[model samples]
Target: MRRCPGGRSWRRAAWRLRCFRFVKIDCYSIETNIQIFAVCASVARRCGYPNRPDRGGGPMNFSARGLSAMFSVLRQRNFAIYTSGSTVSLIGTWMQRVTVGWLCWELTGSGAWLGLLAFADMFPSVIVGPLAGAAADRWDRLRIARISQMLGLLQATFLFVALVAGFLTIELLFAVVLFHGVVEAFNQPSRLALIHSLVGRERLGAAVAINSIAFNLARFVGPAIAGVLIATVGVAWAFALNAMTFGAFALALAAVSLVRDDALAPRSGFLREIVDGFAYSVRHPGIGPILMLMIAAGVGGRAVVELLPGFAADVFGAGPIGLAALTSSVAVGAILGGFVVGVRQSYTGLTRTVIVSVFGIALAVAAFTVTDTLYLGAAALAVAGFFMVTTGVGSQTLVQLAVDGSMRGRVLSLHGLIFRGGPALGALLMGVSSEFAGLRLPVAVGAAILAICAFFALTRVNAIADALENEPRN
Candidate 1:
């Protein structure tokens, strides 16, 4: 028999890949030829032949400068490292989320079940968020984060094992997801509060935008991968991959050294502190109104994201691939929005933008619900996603800029609660209503509610800008 060009099969393949040569082609089978081509393509990529050497002209230079401006927050070493690890972890999180949603659909095929799953994954925040925020304020934020990540790893591992062993019933999944929601409730505030410490007040907007960019980037990639895994191998492996990502993030959290000291001593009981957080967020002029706007958007607009499987499987009849494409399209638009927010040095016109995005998302989602075409629906969802990111990042940065240092953790926890919980509440309501009225009609009504909220919010835009954009006196 004629062997490959080198000694052993793997060695010969490696040698051929390294040398970029194919000799005596008749000696190789078609399978071997395909393998060799794949290896050569990988080698080509590693050798940096993406663009022609002469292509580094003015347009290329301009593009590079723009990207540099967009990612300027990465100049801070700690923020860069943290962002990298979090991006990896968030990708796995999204993968697991998509897998679970698909698995639920496979098992029950009920929109109500899917909505319940999302609720279990998010509603624990309503119960635990305030206390967790208090803990974040009183304890070491990094330590809390590291522990939460380790717990996340544990949860992902358990999920993998259970799914593989065929023991993961819907009830069990609900319990496990609810536990994860509680862990996230604790983790969110600590992690968010760390942003100020990592990059300081000056770069806070860019850092928040960069963080959102990382999240949506993961959102873009993870579901596509999960869909492929589910179509080919299964859901168990997706959970396995997610577990590894959690471990990676834990290691990253361990590696970072903080530039700012955010350590605080406990001055009161946990309940007292929790109550104070609620009152403070309620009373703050800019923070209060902005958060109310987020609540409305989260319930009316963001819940549609959690209900996407129904849209893909039932509405579009395009199945898992359609689901991935739809989710990725949203992420693409959010990434674009993040870039828009990231490059801005000032908060000028941002509050108004936030209000506009509320209206924008309402219109986009309404358009999306009315569309029967999958491609048109994806386009509409992308517009909604752009507005979603704009609203989320703008409101978050404003809150961060306007809040007192001591109250950061609690205030941010309230933000997290609304971010997660509002959707949970809306999903459950819309999901149940969909069973009676159909998915499209319920979603349209929710969008109308969002638009109404945005109209009222428009009147307070100037006051919000004055309170949020100006430096806090305290």
Candidate 2:
């Protein structure tokens, strides 16, 4: 088999090249398509030879060398810098998130206030997501992201100062959080859509996978660090630390230059662009089902992570430590799943992966729902997290692969809504369900729903794969 010209892993970039053929691939071929694209292709380039092998007919290379090749996306100069900075910043962001919730409880001591604060932060996704996505298409994504991070820094600074000076009230907290959410509505789409420019589309899947690993690693470490800071110095330090992290990310963003392709998708009316984006996604067979499965993950029992405190104290009798352990377990599993996704070579396997992992999440959640032992429940949660990452990250890769450059921002913004917003919706349902039936019943019911949805979504994905394989090239 011929190797791609660049030293990059042809396997990693291969999907962006050859997978549209929808030809079958094996573990060996899947294993060795090491270069995501021998070199990242310019997104604006018209259809030509895949910059690398999207599919390779190479003989098996099953040595331990293949393991190292999994993270080949890091070889890109800009992506490595971005990953380093994001990992640091995300840790702080996670820490602040934990601190904010604790601060809210400390100030108000009411679950309802906690719920309201969460609502303030997440509700913007529904209202402003599409508008932000439209702006992503019209303006420079790097500028939007950098500006958003700067605002986030300001929000953190204001909160830190206000808390230290005793200037914060519960109402002030809500307002501060609401401001952060609004910034995020603009930032999230730009950030998600910008990855294509960083490493190029060939390595997009690996880039997304490695990103999840960084995020989950931060997720595991950040809150634990925040917990210590809260116990040792005070919660205000967490906010201050978070503000500093925002500066780090802004600098990182400044260091990386994003390639702009204005001609790729000519600008249209903002509202019309939003309308066109929605129409494009809905008409695509793959995007619809992939998003639905993601929604299911959001609404499914995997989201029980939000309700872990109840399980930790009420059911397991292990209290806060058990809660920490449960969440940490999930993060650990997710990090591993990120490795699986980052290295994977074939989109052919993704349809099956999405379906199987969703079912795996259902079973894992069901087991957790019924388990009384603290350790046992934590184990179940880990399994659920592993499958959840597999499903979410796999769906994300598929979604990115499915859309054109014009629709990338809007489509991914919708995905961001489902990925982030779905859990908020699920949390509300679970809270209400707990009031009516009990903890176990709502989760049990959700797990069953997820399984049913996975099977249904599978039918749509098969059609999607077929359509993509058959799409005529320009």
Candidate 3:
């Protein structure tokens, strides 16, 4: 076999993979072949699979190696268990979300009610996130996550019961959604901080990326499952299914053990700690700036995603199919982007990647605004989604790696608050603006805002990298 530029090691792996698969290697582009080879080799080393010289060893399994690398963080036994349960729970969560939205529309037949429902689901983070963060730091993170998930299961069960018993109303539905929103507000920070204990600092980035991949995967799968259930059995079954998943996750949480727990010393007042988390994040050179960048993209660039339905109806004239196409495109891009970032072994160039992704998202959205064709618009939105996940996951991974252990929950809560709430605020503003100025221009202006923020971030990349990457662990 002729040697490739990547050297003999990867080539040998590729040759072995090619022989095992029994397909023509030339069917895939050389570049694609190289990537497959690289991922196979890297996963082999990481997962303790054999990739030594072409001795009389057995044939290599490229697919197994690729999957191992994609889920490399699962090597942490606790995380693997946690992830197994959470994956089931997340799919159910999405099912419930879709069912609830459909039920709301059926009852009210008002777009205004749908907007209000979305606001209720998202706005609690603004009020509850800081306090929740403080609680995560003060109490046991695993305990908090388990309790919140249990509450989620109960919420789903109640919704199902109410719907079956003929006592459900719009007011009750609204109230229940708001209650669950508060539960999730508490859940987000604790669950995120808990990953550190389960996986340790070395695998934190991979864990975060894997979490995102699972989320996007469920985003696609859940709606399809919900649609089938809602159409055939009943809308109530979606909630029932969600309740089961939540129970599974809660049980899984009970089964896992933490590898490294952050000792929560008795701190000052709870309110003081919340304030201190904010103060520390604001004062830190690296976190402070990247956070500001995230907010800009969240409000401006990310907000556009929430308005895609309007774009489909008004700009593309494709209706539900157009909306589904655009939505699926985004999900595909996000999953692919998460997979790409998940394989990294270091944070060496991640800061720059984060900054560049901000620009990529902005430009992609800007391109989307100008396109009148549905296919082109979907393509552009896919690019936006790719950059959107990269920016989110990248910023989050950096924050997780840089934050002091004591402040992990509090700082991450701030990150979670902006991640969940910023786009809601932006969507409200941009949605209203679209009513007066039209949809395209408001989205275009939001992209412009994001581009400007990226330009500012470009100037500070080196400083942010040094502060985030070089900081000593607590």
CA RMSD per model (angstroms):
10.6, 14.8, 13.3
Which 10-residue window of candidate 1 scores lowest in summed lDDT? 53-62
Query: In candidate 3, what residue range of length 10 has the lowest lDDT sum?
Result: 49-58
Error of 1 at 203 (Å): 1.0
Model 2 TM-score (2 dp): 0.81
Model 3 clash pairs are none
lDDT by residue (tens digit), candidate 3, 29-126: 22332343344334334322233223211123336565586577777778889998998998898777667766775686544455456566766888
The local lDDT score (0 to 100) that residue 79 gets in candidate 2 is 83
1-474: candidate 1 lDDT, tens digit per residue: 112355569986675563342222112222332343343334223322122222110011125676686578798888888998999999999998888888888888888988998998887888888888898889888899899999999999999999878798988988888888889887888988888889888778779999999999999889878866765567888999999999999999889988985557368899899999899889988899999999999999999999999999999986777787778778867876676667554566677778877887898899989987776787777777777987899889889888888888899999999999999988888888888988999899999999999999988777877888775632
Write the candidate numbers in order of decreasing TM-score.
1, 2, 3
Q: Candidate 1's error at 153, in angstroms?
A: 1.0
Candidate 2: where is the Cα deviation over 4 Å?
1-63, 106-112, 259-264, 317-320, 435-438, 468-474
Report every candidate's CA lDDT.
0.81, 0.70, 0.76
Alpha carbon lDDT at 297, candidate 2: 79
lDDT, residue 168, candidate 2: 94
* Candidate 1 residue-wise lDDT at 288: 93
Q: Which stretches of candidate 1 lie over 4 Å from their true place?
A: 1-66, 263-266
**Greater-TM-score candidate between 1 and 2:** 1
